[model samples]
Target chain A: MDQTILDTLHDVIVVGSGCTGAMAAQTLLESGMKVLMLDGGMMDSKYKSLIPDTSYTDFRQKADDQYKILIGENLEGLNWGEVSTGAQLTPPRKFITDQVEIFLPLESNNFHPMESLALGGLGGAWGLGSCIYSPPELEKAGLNANKMHEAYRVVSDRIGISASNDDASPYTSGGFNYFLPELEIDSNAKSLYDKYKKKRNDLNRDGFFMGKPALALLTEDKGERKKCSYNDMDFYSDKDKSAYRPWITIEEMKTKYKNSFIYLGEKLVKEFSEENNFTTVTCIDMMDNSVKTYSCIKLVLASGVLGTARIVMRSVKSENVKFPILTNPYCYIPCIQPGMLGKSADQRRSDFAQLSLFHDPDKTNADVAMASIYSYHSLMLFRIIREAPLNFKDGRKMMRWLLPAMTIMGIHLPQQASEGKYLKMMKDENSPTGDKLFAEYSLNEEEKLSRKIREKKFLHAMRKLNCFAIKKIDPGFGSSIHYAGTLPFNDNEAEFTLNPSGRLNKFKNIFVADGSGFKYLPAKGLTFSLMANAHNVAKTVIEDARK
Target chain B: MNFAEENKYNSEAQILSNYLVGTQVDKKSLELYSGISKTTNHSMNESDLKIWNFLMKHPGFISSIDGALAFTNPKSSVRKKIFFMFAILECRPELSAKFMSSNFTGFYWVKFIWYGVHAVFTTIFGLFLLQWIKRF
Candidate 1:
């Protein structure tokens, strides 16, 4: 044990500065409760400085030093013909998982996990898809629907959302109060929308719903952040602040409540215990590898499922205990629009998904699968060229010939808790945290059949809309980057399970603020719902403390 | 890792670039490619130069060269190094427009037909060569 910092005892200490952690700190700070956030946040200073404030076309056409930013100083994103999680992440955004393995270690042969301890966690490179969860989805995820309804609006207002009320509204993008103007669809997506509109009735009868996406990207200028310039550099950088990163909120709260809120970075929290009427958090200062302790009235474990699970299990001295886990089964379908081929892509366009599609053949909306439609351009031509059957030189030419017509549709299906898929973390002396997590997830035959059947329906739906699905690549588990259900919410008290109010039933002042308690993982992007749940959890913590 | 090894890989990259572009080694484009390899901090495998020298003649074999190399030496894949070099060089401010314009060739319909036929032949040829090499 190193020195203990007995500074002014804080009221609330939130761990992790990602989407959920930021929201939890925001709600607590708003209510005048002083909050301190301990995080092992990382930022790619080398890559960050290299991000030039210019459009993709201009950079590709003018920047002589473009290779430094595109390929990375060390070929960090180098594709070795092996598709792993975080492989699609570009050079600039590589910091999201920069030192995650060294900081938070895990070993799994089947499950390839993508965990982020970056400043904004994994959400720094978020696609900005802001979908409001239905009441049924909230219930299934073990969240209070009534509470989430208000938190959804609160989260929507805090991090601005822009969505249009259209055909996919009832299932995907409706029921939110705070709104910005909808983003314009790209030409490739525009043609798909036109085709969808013509056959709306027949398509609706078949359970394929299409509409404009609800993205967190700003469509209109909001305060200091400018509206999206459509520079088509959504993946490379967010210098213009058009897209909302959770760090933006954390930064704002830092200034507004400077005295009340404190963000201590480089703190890898290990475990917590309720001692002497104070929740004491023991963490390792990664800077000097010194064990440090901080005491607060309440502690919020918002370091995501992987991080939070390790801490709770370690705190309780549990080892190799099987815990249920859930992740969205994901697939990427490359399709072609014959009409858009042999033409130049629009000079001003962003890589954000322009269209949203949901397929629920039974129309029950219970097991609905979702897909986001994006027009490919800025990721450059190397990826397609290597995958094509032709030689390198000819493949390059064939790709450019097929460039304008290409539309990549990433599909995701809802995940359920099964005996087959569970995670277990054990004590390890060699590990940095003295604990190692191992995940085992295998899709059952019925689950595989369900996914295949739903994907075929979605493929058919795309074909009807004039886009032909050429090939579908199943990127395997954890590719969707959606991890949840490790520490679930149950009404009864247990060692690892959490209560509805977000409390770890074994401890007094500890709350699992992130998606670890999500009993079910929705097919849609879970960032928005994670923020809402964190806000609701913070409020419940405040309420419980008052009582 | 050593100065000699770095220089050797850089020289090999220059040869691969010239062969792929089918043009005289433009010093500036070659320099750009060399600079990127240096920045990538990539240590070319001992087998890489040999593999590049071997594959330079078979342009149609570029697609299978990575699989073939991986079969022999798990670390020696020419796909990423060569394609990445080609990708950045093609994106050069001075040459991107020219290459892009070529893709929209006026006789694209003829080229599309040619691409299909060429693809079939390349697949057959590359697989045959890959199997032959894998035996060793």
Candidate 2:
């Protein structure tokens, strides 16, 4: 509506307001550069109006009562009970876009990706599991360790990470500073920690190291954000703003640098091209159905891996261009610790996985696997029961008795780019977004073997802690919600590769700050690394602009 | 009750039950359920009627039925789903009995036995492990 905001050609145009885009904008704004962020999704205000300031129990009760009318029947076999934390349905904030087009090879079975076109992108519904890659892991992923360390510290300071230097330090490579106190471990998690402490030598020999997981959630009040209420509502609601969301940074940038930073919502960018030393981005404004063009001196593509890839593929006009994608192979194993059964469910605490188990059996190879521990109460029992081979009724009864004693371990295994696993873009005239993105991903034989070995080690560790792993369910691929490597950054520039600073090889002024530039994806959560990488790239952009 | 009235009530109850269980229902049934809620002023949508019928059939749910229906609302979709989930919770006893008594063929019987043995062994092992660790 403001003519002045659109009239001026911005110095930098950052697309997507996710973790990377927001961080990139923050760094550039601090350097006194005007930045305009364009997003396809708008924030939904209903979430705040509906469940404002309600306790965890009341929220759950309210949600359960209204779920039938709100969500209707589980038409797509989605267990509505698990809607809070599960990746089956798009959360309210991310309900703006339709499911991205995906075509899987017949041989590639059970790979379902969870993508979001929300204002903050996938970070809006993230688990807040934040972990930095170790030096060796970073090197294996084709990134410089020295630069990454500085970037990690800068990003960590901006978005608070709560973690302690514990036994897992050897595996996690503990050198970075944190902003908040570590969250308290639950009774079941505490038991596992004690067992790890007592049997440290044995577990170490077996390549299993356990400790408190670092989280993006705040434990103390910082700026406008309050401390975590420990209400176990991290999955469903963000009432407290304690758990860090990238939109918080975007909001801050809007207020602190109102004149310099501008956010254009509901604008789906189609493609971009460079002409006369200026980059021109063509986008469709979903609100008014208007095709608009914006030109900038520098353009940064942080619209996530799939989104950035789609834009690049469309711009390059190549259907045969194949970019390798790496996703963490994910599985959920439910373990029962009878001692923790029948505990009071009313206790308030952070429900996100409080502990992480890291295993690097063959330390020589860059193969790493992590298992995050979540209490049974955090998940809906019906979903777990539905996984059983028994009839629904029997499964429900079993779940009722077993849920109290159960703690789920979300296992993540490292995956690399393979011939069978890559993303392809196809031109679809019928698609409202102009292009359809097809991702074909399948675990190779070697990766499958590796997963079995890693899973065995996880189960063995659980047994040593006196907990039995009753059942293991692989929710298939892409459920890990960590997608990367469509346009990998390489030292030697290639057709689909970017330079170390995330500048696409062919285009000098175009840059990529999202997971699209990752060559290799480790088993750890990718949000923290994405933020650091974006911050690092912002510095390069600022330097380049000055020159 | 007259046969016509009894038939109408049964048909409405069936529609409500089917809708709650995720079965496709006609718009006529939806409108009928809405009309009934309006007349009775009970906040009883399709989901609530399903729950009410289940409660009447199984008196065992009487204890927790009030808590289940406390948040029922005809206008709110979220409240409707929650009410149905509560109904499922209250009817768990009957549901479990039905599952236990269901007929099974040869391979199904084998599967049932296998799961039964596995469940028993795990429960015993879990209890024993808990007590042993408690001693530490």
Q: What TM-score, over all chains together, does every model reach?
A: 0.92, 0.79
Which candidate achieves the best DockQ against the true structure? 1
State candidate 2's TM-score.
Answer: 0.79
Highest-scoring model, TM-score: 1
Docking band of candidate 1: acceptable
Clashes of each: 0, 11
Compose the digit string of candidate 1's lDDT tens values, residues A1-547: 1132346578999999999999999999999998889988788798677778888888888887666676665545556566667667888898888778787878777788788878989888788888877777788989898888888889888788888888887665654547787888887788889999999888889898999888898888889999999988888888988898989988999999988988888899998888867988989888888888898999999998888888887788764688888999988888999977776677688888889998767876666789999988888776555555455655665777777789999998999898889888866787778778888889899998988888888988888888998778877798888889988998888878999889988778889889988998989888899998999999988997788
- Tens-place lDDT digits, model 2, residues B1-93: 466755654454444344333333334333334334333334455654554555446533322333222222222332334333423332233
Least well predicted 10-residue stretch by lDDT in candidate 2 chain A? A98-107
Question: Model 2: how far is A356 from its true place, Å?
Answer: 0.1
Interface RMSD (one decimal) of model 1: 4.2
With candidate 2 superimposed using the best TM-score fit, by how many Å does residue A301's alpha carbon deviate from the native? 0.4
